[model samples]
Target: MTTADALYTVNVTINGQPHEVKVPARRTLVDLLRYDLDMTGTKETCSVGVCGACTVLIDGEIAASCITLAVQADGANITTIEGVANGEALHPLQQSFIDHGGFQCGICTSGQIVAAKSLLDSNPSPTEDEVKEWMMGNLCRCTGYYQIMESILKASK
Candidate 1:
C-alpha cells in the first residue's frame, strides 16, 4: 500500500497470540480487534474516546482502543477483555464483580474488567476511593457504578 493510500499491515500480539492483519491506516484499534480479528471482547460505545467502553491494555497500560489506530498498536502487546479470564476459572476481578453484583446490563462489564485489571496489576490493594477514581473511565449506565466500585475494591482486598 502506498503512503497516500493509508493502508498498512500491522503485527500485534493479542492475548499472547501473534496476529498479522492488513488494516487501513485510519482504522481504530477497536475496529481491528472486533471486526477484522473477530475479537468481540472489546466493546465500543462512544467512538470518540471519552467513554472507556473501548478500553484495552497496550503493553499493560490502559488505552482507549476506539481512538487508537491499529497501526499505532503494531508490535504492541494488547490484552482485551477476552484475555482477562481463563477457561472456567474467572480472574479475581471477575469473581469479585460477580460476587459484588458489579454488572447489571453487562455492556460495560468488559471495559470495567479490563480497567480493573490494569489497576490490580499496578496496585493489588486499592482503596475504595482509589478504585472509584481509577475506574472513572468506564461508565456503567445501569449499575450506577456502586457495585462496580465495590467489586474492584473487594478484588484488591
Candidate 2:
C-alpha cells in the first residue's frame, strides 16, 4: 500500500463542533472541509497556497486549507467560512461585502471574508493601508479590490 492508502483519524473542533474523522494522510484540509464536512463555503482555487482561495482559521490564525493536510491539523480548532457568522445574523464583514459590493462571480468571497475576519479579530480597527496589506493575499478576478478593501475597513469599525 502507498502512503495515500494509510488512513488516520483526525480529531478536531470545527466551528465549535467536535469531530472524529478518518481520512487518507494525503487529504488536504480543504477536502476535509468541503467534501467530508460539507463546508463548501471555503472555496478551492489556484490549488496552490499563494492565492489564499482556501484560507481558513486554524487555531485562530490564517492558513491555506488547500495546502494544509488534514492530519496536520489534528487536535486543532478550525474555523471555516461557515463558522464566522451567527445562525442567521450575518457577520459584519459578510454584510459589508454585500453592502460594499466586495465580490463578483462569488468565488473568492468566502476566503476573503474569512481572512478579513481573522484580521478584524486581531485588530478590530485597522487602517486602510493595513486592510490592503492584510488582504493582499486574497485575489478577486472580478472586483478591482477597492470594494473589498473598503468592506474590510468598514467592517473593522
Candidate 3:
C-alpha cells in the first residue's frame, strides 16, 4: 500500500492483553474498542466527549475515548468497563451500583462504572461531595444523581 493508503499498527494492552491492531489515523479509541475489537462495555453516548459515556482507563487514568485517537493509545494500557469485573463476579463498584440503584435504563452504566472506578482508585475513601464532583463528567438522565452518589460512596466504604 502507498503511504496515503497505509494503515497504522498500534500496539496496546487492553484489559491486560497485548494487541497489535491496524487502525486508520482518524479512528477514535472508542471505535477501536467497540467496533474493531468488539469491546461493547465502553458505551458511546456523546461522540463529542462531553457525556463521558466513552470513558476508559488509560494506564489507570480516566480519559475520554471518543476524543482520543486510537494512534494515541499505542503502547498504553487501557481498561474498559468489561475489564472491571472478575469473570462472573462483579466488581465492588458494579455490585454497589446494583445494590444502591445507581442506574435506571442502564445506558449510562458503562460510563458511570469507568468514571467511578477512576474516583475509587484515586480516593478510596471519598466523601459524598467528592463523589459528586468527580463523577460530574458522566451524565445520567435517570436517578437524578442521588443513587449514583450513594453507590460510589458505598463502594468506597
Candidate 4:
C-alpha cells in the first residue's frame, strides 16, 4: 500500500479509558493523544525524544510518546498528566509541584510529573540522587531542576 494510504488501527487504554482509533502509519502517539483523543497534557518538545517533554507511562513504564508510533502503543495502558490527578484533587506530585515551585514556564511540568510518577511507582521513597538521576532526561529550559527535585522528594514522603 502507498504511504499516503497506510493506516493503522490502534487500541489503547488512556488514562483508564479505552480508545480505538485509525491513524496514519506515520502518526506518533503524541499526535494521536493530542489530536485524535484531545488529550493535550502530553507536550512535544525536541521531537527527538531527548528532551523527554513527551514522556508518558505505557504499561507503567516511561515512554517518549513523540518517538513512539501510535500503532506501537496498541494494547498499551497510557497515562498522561491528565490521568495523574484524582478528579478535582491533585496527585501528590502535582500538589508538591505547585507547593514547591517545581515548574516555572510549565512546558516541561507534565512530562516531569509523569516521569516522577513512574519513578515513584517503581521506587517509592527514592533518594534525592535517584530522583535527579531518573529525571535527568527531562529537561526544563526554565532551569527549575532544584524545585522539581524537591517536588518529587516531597511527594515521595
Which candidate number would show the highest lDDT if scored against the true structure? 4
1-157, model 1: which lDDT tens digit per residue?
3676766999999999999999888899999999999999888998988878889999999999999999999999999999998977799999999899999888888998999999989989888778878888788888568788788887885
> Across residues 35-113, which tens digit of lDDT does each residue of candidate 4 receive?
9988888999999999999999999899999999998899999999999999999999999999999999999999999
List the candidates ranked by TM-score, beginning with the highest: 4, 2, 3, 1
Ranking by lDDT: 4, 2, 3, 1
Candidate 3 ranges with C-alpha deviation above 4 Å: none
At residue 54, give the lDDT of candidate 3.
87
Q: List the global CA lDDT of all models.
A: 0.89, 0.91, 0.89, 0.93
lDDT score at residue 26, model 3, on the 0-100 scale: 86
Error of 2 at 43 (Å): 0.7
Structural RMSD, model 1: 1.4
Best by TM-score: 4
Candidate 1 total steric clashes? 0
Q: Which candidate would rank higher by lDDT, 2 or 4?
A: 4
Question: What is the per-residue lDDT of model 3 for residues 13-54, given as tens digits with 9 covering 90 to 100?
Answer: 998989899988888999999888998888888799898888
Candidate 2, 155: how far from true, in Å? 1.2
Residue 130 lDDT in model 1?
A: 81
Clashes per candidate (backbone, < 3 Å) = 0, 0, 0, 0
| Window of ten residues with lowest summed lDDT in model 1 | 1-10
